[model samples]
Target: MSPDADPRSAPTSPRPSGLWRTVAEIERHVATDGWGAPLRLFALVRTADALDRDPGLARRLPPNVLDEARADPDHLTSVEQEGVPAVADLDELLGQLAWPDGVDGAALVVERILVPPDAETEVRAVTAGDDEAGRARALAAHPLAEDVRIAVGVLRDGRHECAVRSRSKDSDGEVATGADLVPGLVGALAATLQD
Candidate 1:
């Protein structure tokens, strides 16, 4: 899911209760900053259950994510107690997932990008390139990325142009509590928008 996404309320998943539990855990951690050891233990178990449903989607919770979750037990007490620390530490980890290159920029290489700022910018359409067309389609779909077209050869050496339309704008937890929230947010938003 893109970083700026705001997930609508999830009304349709098998784990509505689990979602509430996760969200409660998040709120507890966010509010008290002291999610308690019980919260941590519960989170681990719930996360395990959530992961069991879809073993394929690990980007939201890479193998090392728990390590981030493990960093601050004291902060796990509650949102006000652990909220700042959990929010800070977890966001530190989530931000890494959001901005893998340490926030400077991402290794962007597009075969076709519909330039955002100006539609008249040079563009190209190449079938030989690998990621260009797909990336172009994605960029074209975003509301922030409009008025751009792919020219045949406008961007051979060019990468991303650092615009308002980026994939990981908010560092996940910067908005929500966990990067794990991304998939849910994506699903919820897709359903809402589709409806």
Candidate 2:
């Protein structure tokens, strides 16, 4: 089965039940810091039988899907493979999610991208270049390509979010998002289960 087709292939889980609280903290940061680009959130969930109870899986799934996993979970199925429809009211959206009878756990991967305010001008310049090399060079110099800060975070079955990857001025270049970025809050939303 395709990795996206099987939840068993999903990454190991993060600390359960801590994801939501962690997410709340992250959200506050996002609210204050604000995103320079649109933030996207993706959720991956599998059947309860599939998780096999591995504790660390789903704790750190990147925003992208996994190609393979060591041991696939049983009765694996997809809950929401595509990006969530809306993040405008992320807290309210997360508050409405719940796992049905068959689902075991899930991972929430949030990506916040920041493009330099002047990216459009740079892109136009790149497109106007006559040769491939010139175009490539121009594109490389664009803020969207180089001057970008991405925050990626994963939250799983447990309530709390964990292991964030991000690019904040404060973070020296850690792969995980910190409070300076907002994936933590997004992670919490995905891990949380509400009525």
In model 2, the runs with Cα more than 4 Å from the true position are 1-80, 111-161, 168-173, 177-191
Where is model 2 poorest over a 10-residue stretch in terms of lDDT?
63-72
In candidate 1, position 130 carries an lDDT of: 67
Each candidate's lDDT (Cα)?
0.29, 0.44
Q: Score every model by TM-score.
A: 0.17, 0.33
Q: Count clashes in each candidate, considering only residues at least 3 apart in sequence or on different chains.
A: 35, 30
Cα lDDT tens digits, model 2, 34-83, are 43544544333442334345545445543222222323332233343445
For model 1, the superposed segments whose C-alpha errors exceed 4 Å read 1-15, 34-43, 46-195
State candidate 2's TM-score: 0.33
Best by lDDT: 2
Residue 129 C-alpha lDDT in model 2: 47
Question: lDDT tens string, model 1, 24-80?
Answer: 344333333321222121111223434445565446665565453344221111111
What's the residue-level lDDT of 122 in candidate 1? 26
